[model samples]
Target: MEKNVKQIVEQVIKDVEVKNPGQSEFHQTIEEVLTSLIPVLEKNPAYVDAKILDRLVEPERQIMFRVPWVDDKGEIQVNRGFRVQFNSAIGPYKGGLRFHPSVNLSIIKFLGFEQIFKNSLTGLPIGGGKGGSDFDPKGKSDNEIMKFCQSFMTELYRHIGPNVDVPAGDIGVGGREIGYLYGQYKRIRNANDQGVLTGKGLTYGGSLARTQATGFGIIYFVEEMLKEAGKTINGQTVVISGAGNVAIYAVKKAQELGAKVVAMCDSSGYIFDEDGIDLPLVQQIKEIERKRIKEYAVRKPSAKYFEGNKGIWTVKADVVIPCATQNEIDLNDAKIIVENGTFAVGEGANMPCTNEAEQYFLEKGILLAPSKAANAGGVATSALEMTQNSMRLSWSFEEVDEKLHGIMVNIFKNTRDAAKEYGFEGNYLVGANIAGFIKVADAMMAQGIV
Candidate 1:
């Protein structure tokens, strides 16, 4: 990187850090993305002249509100809600609504910042934004969950619309939650706006393949990466973290491609089945029964249960996909996986790896598929759902799945091509950041400073 360009990037990082104090997550993402833009800034002086990075780092709008609702116990409960409309240069604000106890402005900003690039990679007409509440949905009754969703949408609906901002599911938000939120949005607006949210139930406006989009998308992207390295998923050992929607479907797809997924996990612990994980049983425990993954071991004699989620990385495998939360794989986990001869890692969650861990894998020549490029299928399909709603037509599952596969394949090619074009061939993290950045940056530049 040239000295001038490097200095400009450093200054932007310092400004974001100072402005957003105590927001370690937001600072981390800003540092990562801005640092990667050095090469671009050196070659293209127009971006810096326009002060694009300064405008990009700050969101157009940030909404924070208090959500009050009645619990099943007849007690009044309060939670904080957030919606960061980061950028909408290309299209409307499009991202997921994550409901977890860990959500804060920093986390939401990080996710929203990353979404700008992720949505761009999908080749869909959508921009970046993200929202969620710091409410823990665990152990909440169905009525309680509905109450919280209703209270959340009461404020959120004012800021969001079908063509303005569309919110989908992430973390604790899913079909049930989306249904309730949509119901409340309908009641408040007195309009049938199916396009206001994605990930809805089949009888409603949800797309058919939306449920498995992220997991399947990751596999599709990984498959292309492996093929470029003269490899395939056949007869490979795989270990995945998380037993939620992303992990479960990722296991199913990898198994279908002839890979033996040996282990999977929930927040509590992981279950390992040497022969191969039983996807049906995992789905039952996680989806239907909503039990811990340890139940898999109790039900299947061959499977063994571990006490911690991080221990699953110890198992040797050809591929390791972290479908869990951010920074789940630290430097130690990366060292262990690299030492165990893991060939590649495809991220199924947002920023699932720490900076040091990602660096270690890249140093060891591991094939890495960054989350922005790999896990874009969900949002891409959500865009497809938005299209169906606008057209008032729905497609079959196979049709949606085919479209998703094509999008993932194209994302891989574009990222790979961008890396090669910039003399950073095989550095997918840089490639993804650059490829996604260029598109959004071009759009930002075309539009006058806003």
Candidate 2:
């Protein structure tokens, strides 16, 4: 923490220090936002004068539980589950619940903290929250998944509702995972509460365009920026990281706009298809076929797959969409990316780049959009799902998609305007930090001190 900023916030700092023994990720999230929002507090005296910072950083509720289920061999497996409802001033707690092996309280808190601002930037009525577990879903049997989800929801259903914390999906938790969780929620609650969850199967209460919402939303935001700058995605060579849901849709939309997606990756390795990646093959493999990205070479024999731990940042391109995990691209990778003529980086995942990587981009005047701003599409659509549920009506695919486009466009403009106001001139971290801080901070101030 910086001395001057820490000095001003010493009281709140002490409170947090006493409460938290060693949750580094959670502390990092808080320190980052608190360090940046000093200017916001200066202008909005109600924020500082009222101690809004303290309240905004704390979670409204944190739920922790154990999920015990029988695996295929009739073996008992126990895993921890968590949900950190970070805020509710703007709207209900809306976010995703990942089911990866890496899920933890610290990670969820960091994600939920970032979500508060991300949801605010969408200009939608959604508050920040996130949940997940350390349960590894990979290679798990369908029966095991059903049992695990049922056991997880057995305890989780008590904490969630339509107007309360509504979790969708993240990393390992997708439509299938959401379906299992939703089914359990319904069975336990004995109510057909459609609003209790988002990211359902379209055959059920799922919204249209929800599948491609986050990925398409990234392109939608970039398109708005490009339109304002009198440029376009047409003819741009893009390097996209990750072969997941967000990355696949980003590739599809960029190609639709005539951009050439040259690279994409997975945990095993990255693939570079100079002739342009086949978006359909990617969709088929990752989504439908449910296989590794190395299969891409099998489909298109010309595609090059580089094994080992390397990321996609080494690819030379005009735009870099980091759709991978946090810290996937570091300072060295940032330099390589900038040296390779990369002009913009739109984060498709949460904190995919390190602080140094971000600083390198900002110093070089690259168009760096933070994950909170760039990847709010999923939660934004989740909010739309809640709206439909509350109204007892479902919107058509086109309707929800158009609304998504409008919201993304608005978010881009807000970030741009905030940057210009802060003298950061297109520094999206500052822009997004300031823009999102204002709304929640104001609401917190008006509510008065607790």
Please tell me which predicted candidate would have the highest lDDT against the true structure: 1
Model 1 TM-score, all chains together:
0.99
Q: For model 1, how does the per-residue alpha-carbon lDDT over 153-237 read when each residue is reduced to its tens digit?
A: 9999999998899999999999999999999999999999999999999898889999999999999999999999999988999
TM-score of each: 0.99, 0.96
Q: Write the per-residue lDDT of candidate 2 for residues 1-450, one digit (tens) a residue.
A: 235445776667567757876776677667766766766666556555576777776799999999999998989999999999999988889899999998888889989999999999998878889999999988997889889999999999999998888899889888888899999899888998999899988866888888899999998887776676677788999998888889999999899999999999999998999999988888889888789898998889999988853657788899888887877888999999999998888888998887778888989988887888888888899888888878878899899989998889889889989978867776778888899988887776666664
What local lDDT does model 1 show for residue 219? 96
CA deviation > 4 Å runs, candidate 2: 1-6, 9-21
Looking at model 1, residue 269 earns an lDDT score of: 88
